[model samples]
Target chain A: MIDVLTTAWNWIAEPLQYGFLRQAIWVSAFVGLVCAVLSCYVTLKGWSLMGDAVSHAVVPGVVISYALGIPFAVGAFAFGFGATVAIGYIKSKTRLKEDAVIGVVFTGFFAFGLVLVTKIPSNIDLFHILFGNVLGISRQDIIQTLIAGTLTLAVILLRRKDLLLFCFDPNHAKAIGLNTQMMYYTLLSVLALTIVTALQTAGIIMVVAMLVTPGATAYLLTDRFDRMLMISVAASVSACVLGTYFSYHFDVSTGGSIVVLLTVFFVLAMVFAPKYGLFAQRFRQRVYKKQLDEMSSPP
Target chain B: MTMTASSLDITVDDISVTYSNAKLALYNASCMVMPGTITALVGPNGSGKSTLFKSIMGFLQPSQGKIRVGGFPVQKVQKRQLMAYVPQSDEVDWNFPVSVFEVVMMGRYGYMNIFRTPRQKDRRIVMESLERVGLVDFRNHQIGELSGGQKKRAFLARALAQEGKVILLDEPFTGVDVKTEKRIIDLLLQLKQEGHTILVSTHDLASVSTFCDRTILLNQTILASGTTQEVFTEDNLTMAFGGLPISSLRQMTGQMTGQSSHIVNRQTSQNAEVEA
Candidate 1:
């Protein structure tokens, strides 16, 4: 047992010998924390598809940023915000539902991005942007991630009460003199920025998972919003670390590994969570049925 | 404590709301709710009750008319934290993971600091509001865990915490039990006696005369607006609830006879479905 434990320790510790791997782990963990925080809002607001749409819509911005010799985050945020606005506009103009509008807008943006990537001879790799290259993250990218992540986290936590009310009951928010329209736009902006922060770690494709799975996992685990936020952050950060560790040792895609770990956590919560899990729901139903049976048979 | 007894009369004047889709929800609809009175805004489904409430709350912009509270525009009154609103249950995401206390505390947000960190006084007021609504025992419970009536009371507690003199409730009794409905009506009466102005939209006509001092009959426009004894007549009710069975309308106007009460109750349930 001691030999096996030592071997495992070596497998984990040996990767830390490389500075890039250490940076990758920390950066991905930071990205996970931001995504997890916003994920609580995303999942609670039923904006998982919105997250998916915004993340996919960032691709065109990234390709354009590379072409323009500018930072990708600026381009990514512009495209993400633009897509959100477009979705809202189309939904309002036509009788189409929001989901349908989001679907059409995101795919259009993503396809446009694909065309740009192929048409322009650029140094940017579509594979890296689509699936991420956290292991090869640049120092500049790390700094950008930290700044954007910190801003997003601060805004969410500071305005949590109003945002919570807006998501839970928008009419009440408006009645209380809150500008619900501003809150809506602010949340969308935050979502776009969060996607940008997670872009380097999870890429455009799996970033939605980073923004959705953690919040959903926490949702099943708790019935309180504050605890839900804390649980999602804790679970997501750990998943980031563990997934990065495994990715390094197994030579696997880091984004894919992190998303897989997040899914595993969600599945675990869905099955075994104390309050809202599938098994717990089934158990409560059985208990109620048993009590009904006893009452019918006796009294 | 920002709890002032200063009440304001809500004056909705010829407000017409046309949605972007060109659906005219309310046209030239007007009513006045005096301070220290509970006014019932009675109408059938899609008769612009919700639209009128939204206009008063400054949520939907009126394409033509104006709404003023205490001679001030609705927006000004809202900015003063003198207006509180309780939306219909369908308008809220009940499954949200919020504690009963937190939900009530939302009422104090306008009085709170930018970060919305509740002060000790805010907490005390929230506790008092909960006690007033008989929900103190369930303060820590998840809001979704409550019964339909309890959920309605929780939102009422929130409005109480706001210390608003003018309160607007949209269908507060739709899904609630009779006991809870009585409790809510009693609470509203108590608030009214304390000089608060309340405008409630509901399909439950059987109890309007029991509590409401004034009634506004509306069908896209105000059919009648006056004392409950005058405005809640059979003719006005027929104009508002145009397609409802005459028996149900008669029950509403004929002092809620026991048999008619049953029919009204059934009609109330049907209206809940239609509204949803």
Candidate 2:
């Protein structure tokens, strides 16, 4: 047992000495933080699929930016924002439901991106864009991630109350003289920015998991938004750090490891969370039933 | 408290609204609500009561004509923070993880500068609103955990916290218990006494004569609107309900009698005795 503990300690301690591992850790941590914070709004607004749609829709943008020889962030953000607007426009203009519009638009964007990848002969790394290359990030990538993460996090924190009210009840928000249209677009923009920041660490597919899982897990564990935020950040940061370490030790995909850890956390919270957990609720129900039986059959 | 000059006197002039699918919701609806009175908007299920309120609240754009509040256009009045709307409780997502306090504090968002947090004044107002609605003890409770009546009261508390000169409520009495209904009536009377203009949409005709100083009977248009004694007659009700069954009319008359019995006791009761 001591030997196993010693090896585990060394495994975590040795990664601290490497610059690349350190960069990967910090980058993933930042991505996790922003994604988790924004995830609360996304989940509360019932926009989980919207987050998926925007993330997937960025592939063509990334590919186009590479072809244009511009920065990937610019193209990714443009496409992310464009996808959200398109979704909103389609939802508003037609009778189609929001999820259907999102599905059609994102699938079209993803297919277009795949076709572009096949057509282009550039040296753009399709695999890394699709699944991420967190361990291989450079110093410039760290700076970009830092800037994006900080801006997104700050905006979310600053507008947390307004955003919460807007998501919870938009009509009330508008009735109270809030420009709900502005709030809507602001949330969409934040979502796009968060997705863009997370693109490098979790990539398109896994980024949605990072954006959704932490908030969902925290939701199961708490009834208050403030506590939900704290728990989501803690859960996401721990998953990012531990998953990075695990991936390094096992030679697995870092994004995959992080997503797996997030899923584990969600499952645990679902089963064991104090109030809303499955077992806790069932246990309460049984106790109540017992009390009812006692009351009904009293001497 | 002195009545502000901005206490809104709502005026809907020849306004009409059509849904996107081309269904006419309201047709040249017109009414006037004087300041410092609780006006009940009475109509059947699809009589455009909510549509009129929405248009007046600037939620719907009327296809024709205009709506003015406090001598200003609805939009301008809204921008000036002179109006508050409380939609049906069912329209809200109760499962949202907001506390009763947070939900009520949202009322102060209109008066708050963007990017500014709620101050001590805002907190005190929220607390007072909660106390008025009798939910101060439940301030920290999750909104979803509240009973249905409590949810309605919470929204009422939110509207009170807005401190608007004009308040529009969409069916505040629906689905609430008797105690909550009475509390809302008492609160409406208090607000009216405080010089706040209140327009409430309701199907409860009994409470209309008891509480509302004025009532607007609508059926795709204003059939009758004046003091409850003038507008809430059986004739106007029959027009609003598209020939409401005589049985329902008798029940309404029974309620107007203030008798504890639920049976339809009289069809020829004096209208003067029924008028509040």
Candidate 3:
């Protein structure tokens, strides 16, 4: 036990201390919190697909920005925001279901990003786009991700009522004089930024899990938004810290490890959650039905 | 209120809404909604009744005309506190996790600050609204646990929580038990006594005879609109719902008091000023 404790203390160990792993772990912590928190609202709104859409869609923007030698964040932000608005616009203009449009646009844009990446030098590793690597973590990225994530979370947390109203009944919200359009677009923009920051640590491919899986799993276990958010954040942080440690020992990719951990948590929650979960709900139903039958039949 | 009939409330002037696909839902549709009165805006399934109601709230911007509350355009209406809207069930998800009291308190969100906590006044109002809807006992129950009628009553509680002068209820009676339906009607009358300007869109023409002060019948356009006893007639039924005229209809569909087949003028606007 003492040996294990000393080994853990060697997070200050020489070889582990010099490189990017520490920075990567810190950055992943923030990214996980941001994505996981925002995704509570997204999942509640049944717009969980938007996370994958925005994350995958940012690939083309990132590739294009790389080609232009510009900051990838700008391009990703622009395209992600554009796609979010386009989804809303298409729904308003035509009668197409919002999900259908999201599916179509997401696939098309993501494929374009893949093709754009191909057009660039083959030597540059684009695998980071599919599976994020924590090796390149820097001080700047950590600061940027932290500030943006904290601010986004604050804004969303503060406007909990308005945001919840918009998600549940947009028509009622509109009738009440809440600017649905402004709130709608503002949510999209924040989602876009959160996705971009998360992309740095989790990469485009694994980011969806970070965004949705924690929140979705939390939702299965809880009803109140506040509790769900807290659980999601807790789940995300646990995955980040544990996955980072596991990756260090097993010699695997950090983001992939975290996601695998999250998936395991999700599977457990799916079966064992106290209420609304598959197994528990079925068990409760049978018990309730039996009780009702007993009372009505009078033995 | 049992006060007066003709207090100016909602006025739609030359309102027109055309979808981006060039489907025109309403055109130059103009009417007035009087205070303390239940106006049944009736229409066929494909008609523009919903479009007109949505346009009135400024949810759907008019293609050409204007919608006003108390002679003031919708843009000039006060913030989210001014009006309450209850949408049909299809548009709402019953799976959401919220208690009955919490849902009703949602009506006060506009007045509540984002970071600020709910004050005692807000809680009292929410309790009172639930009492008005007769759901005080179920205040702590999760919304998902409520029956269909209880759900409608909960939505009413939310609307009452708004304490708005104007309320727009879309198909409130749909998918409810008959007993629940009458309970809703009684609740509406009570709200009417509270001086609420109520606009309800429904398929029930019988309400044209019983509660609604005026009925706006629309099949894309206003076919005929007037008081219950005035507008419920053979000729208008023939022209409006031609397949089932009032003469051929059973007692359930509607009834005609006498041989006067033409639509009654209702003189509704005239009675608007003095209900009692």
Candidate 4:
């Protein structure tokens, strides 16, 4: 047992000595934190599909940025915001529902990105943009992630109460003189920024998982937003650390492993959480039933 | 503490609301809510009652005309926190993860400066509001755990915490029990006595005659609006609820006659009745 433990320790610690691995871990952890925090609002507002839409829609922006030889964040944010506007415009212009509009717009952008990638002779790796290369991230990528993550966290914290009120009841928020329209766009901008920060760690395809899973798991565990935020952060950070360690030891894809670990956390929370978990709720119902039966029976 | 009451008069002038798809929800509707009175807006479902209220609250823009609150435009009065709105309980997400206390405290958001936390005074007002709605003991409870009636009271408490001179409530009596309904009526009466103007949109004609000083019957436009005794007649109700079964209309008119007579007897000393 000691030998196995020592071998595991060496496996994790040996990767910690490398600068790339250290950067990868830090970036992934920060991405996890920001994604988790924003996920609370995303889930509460039923904007999960919007997160997916924005993340996928960033693909064309990234391809176009590379084509123009500019930084990817600028292009990514523009396209993400553009996609949201397009969805809104289309929904308003036509009778199509919001979900249908989102599906059409994102798939179109994603296809356009694929065509652009194939037509361009640039060295931009479509694989890396889609699946991420966490272990291969450079110092610049790390700094970008750090800055975006910090800004997102600050804005969310500063406007937590207002944001919560807006999501819970937008009409009431507006009636009370809150700039609900501005807040709506601000939330979308933050989501775009958070997705941009996460791009390097989870890539486009899996970033939605990182954005949604941790908050959903925490939601199953708690009934309060503050506690839900704490639980989401803890869940995501731990998953990042553990997944990074295991991916280093096992030589697997870091992003894939991290998402797998997040899924595991979600499943556990769904089954075992005290109040809202499946088993716990059934257990309480059974106990109540037994008490009722006893009360109805002759003594 | 003594409640500082200020009467606010609302004048909705020739307001017309059209949806993005060009559906005319409200067509050149107009009404006047006098200060220090409770006016009930009664209509069938989709009769533009909610649309009118939304336009008044500045949530929905009117394609034509304007709304004025206390001599200021609706938009300006909203910024000054002179109006409070209690939306129907169904409009809110009950599963939202917030405490009853926090929801009530949201009413003070307009009064707060950006980046500032709630102070002692805000907290005291929230607590007082909760006490008024009889939800003081449920301050720490999650909002979703409350019964439907409790949820309505919780929103009422939020409106009370706003301390606005004008309150607009949309369907507060729906899905609530008798006790909660009574409590709400008592609170509205108290607020009216304290010199606040209130407009409630409801489908309950019985409660309209019972509690409201005036009634507005609407069907995409104002069918009739005046003192309860003057406007709640069978013909006006028939105009508002078109195509109603004759038997039910007869029963409804019978009930309206009984209530209108009671209102006439009660308002004999006052000359507040008006025809529309």
Every model: Cα RMSD to truth: 4.8, 4.3, 4.2, 2.9
Q: Identify the candidate with maximal DockQ.
A: 4
How high is the TM-score of chain A in each model? Answer: 0.97, 0.97, 0.88, 0.96
- Can you write out model 2's per-residue Cα lDDT over A1-299, one digit (the tens) per residue? 99999998899899999988998898899899999999888888988999999999988888898899877778888989999999989887888878899999999988888898889877778788888889997666667677777889888878888888889888777666678899899999989889889888898999999989999999999889989999999999999999999999998999999999999999999999999999999999999999999999957
Task: Quote the lDDT for A279 in model 2.
Answer: 97
lDDT, candidates in the order shown: 0.87, 0.84, 0.77, 0.86
- Candidate 1 per-residue lDDT, tens place, B115-179, comes to 89999999999999999999999999999899999999999999999998889999999888889
- DockQ of all candidates, in order? 0.65, 0.54, 0.52, 0.69
lDDT of 3 by residue, B1-276 (tens): 234433348877777788877888887677777766899887767678889888877787887877778767775664735567887777777777677888888877767776537899889999988987889999988788889899998998888888777888989888899899889899888778767889999887665567787777666666666565555555555555656645554363454535334435333423221111
* TM-score for each candidate, following the candidate numbering: 0.94, 0.93, 0.89, 0.95
At residue B51, what lDDT does model 3 achieve? Answer: 92
Residue by residue across B1-276, what tens digits does model 2's lDDT show?
Answer: 236564669988888898867899988777888888899998889889888988888877899989888888876776766888888977888778889999899888877777758899899999999999899999999999999889888988888888888888899888888888898889889888888999999988877878898878787887777776666555556566866685677587554433322322113322211211
What DockQ number belongs to candidate 4? 0.69
Question: Distance (Å) between predicted and true CA of A154, model 3?
Answer: 2.5
First chain of model 1: TM-score? 0.97
Model 2 score (lDDT): 0.84
Better candidate number, 2 or 4, judged by lDDT: 4
TM-score of chain B of each: 0.90, 0.89, 0.88, 0.91
lDDT of 4 at B18: 91
Candidate 4 stretches with Cα past 4 Å from truth are B1-5, B246-255, B258-276
